[model samples]
Target: MDARVDDKVVLVTGASRGIGEAVAAEFLASGARGVVITSRKANNVEAAAERLGEPDRVLALAARSDSVDDAD
Candidate 1:
C-alpha cells in the first residue's frame, strides 16, 4: 500500500519506545516531512527524536495522552 505520507506532518503519541517508536520510523521512511512524537517524559521524547536522527524533520514533545491541555 502506498501511504503517500510524503510532506505530511504526522503526530504520534507514546513514541518513546516500542510500537510507537516503530510507527514514527515507518512514517519517516514513508517520506513524511515532519513527525511529532510525544511521550510522558521530556527526556524520553528528546531521546527518541535524536534516535530518529532527523532534527529538521522530527519534533519531540512531552505530553500525557490523557491530558487535554497537553494536546494543545
Candidate 2:
C-alpha cells in the first residue's frame, strides 16, 4: 500500500457516491496532491469532499457525460 502518491492528481466523475467516491478516497489516502470530483449535483460533491476532511483537495463541478464541459 505504498503507492506514495505524494504529488499525484486524479479526476473522478460520478463521485457524489458509490465507486467513484471510494476511488477518490483511496487516491487521497495514497497521498494524492489533488483530486477533482464531478457530478450532476454540485451540493452532493461539495458535501462529500467536506466529509473527507480535505475540502481544498477536491473540486466539485457539475458535469454531464455526453455533453462535456458542463462547467462552461
Candidate 3:
C-alpha cells in the first residue's frame, strides 16, 4: 500500500467507531499530517484517537451531526 497521502490534513466526522474510524486510521497510516476526529461524545472521540497510538496527531472533538459549527 504505497499511497501518497503524506502531509494531508483530514477531518473525519463520526469517527469514534466503525467505518469512519477505519478511514481515519487509513489516512494516518498513509502519513497524513493531521486528523480531526469528531463524535457526539468527547470520551468516544478521545478514545478513538488514542487507539491510533498518536494522540498528538489527532484532534478529538465532541460533535454531533446536527451541529453546524466548525469546532476547529
lDDT of each: 0.92, 0.81, 0.88
Model 3 over residues 1-72: C-alpha lDDT tens digits? 376779988898999999999989999999999999999999998999899788878898997766667884
Best by lDDT: 1
Tens digit per residue, CA lDDT, model 2, 1-72: 467678878888888888988888888989899998888887888877876677778777877645657588
Name the candidate that leads on TM-score. 1
Q: Which wins on lDDT, candidate 1 or candidate 2?
A: 1
Off by more than 4 A, model 2: 1-4, 66-72
The clash count of every prediction, one per candidate, is 0, 0, 0
Ranking by lDDT: 1, 3, 2
Model 3 / residue 2 / CA error / Å = 7.2
What TM-score should be assigned to candidate 3? 0.81
Clashes of 1: 0
Q: How would you encode candidate 1's per-residue C-alpha lDDT over 1-72 as one tens digit per residue?
A: 268898899999999998998899999999999999999999998999999999999999998886568557
Candidate 2 lDDT at 28 equals 90
Question: Worst lDDT window (10 residues) for model 3?
Answer: 63-72
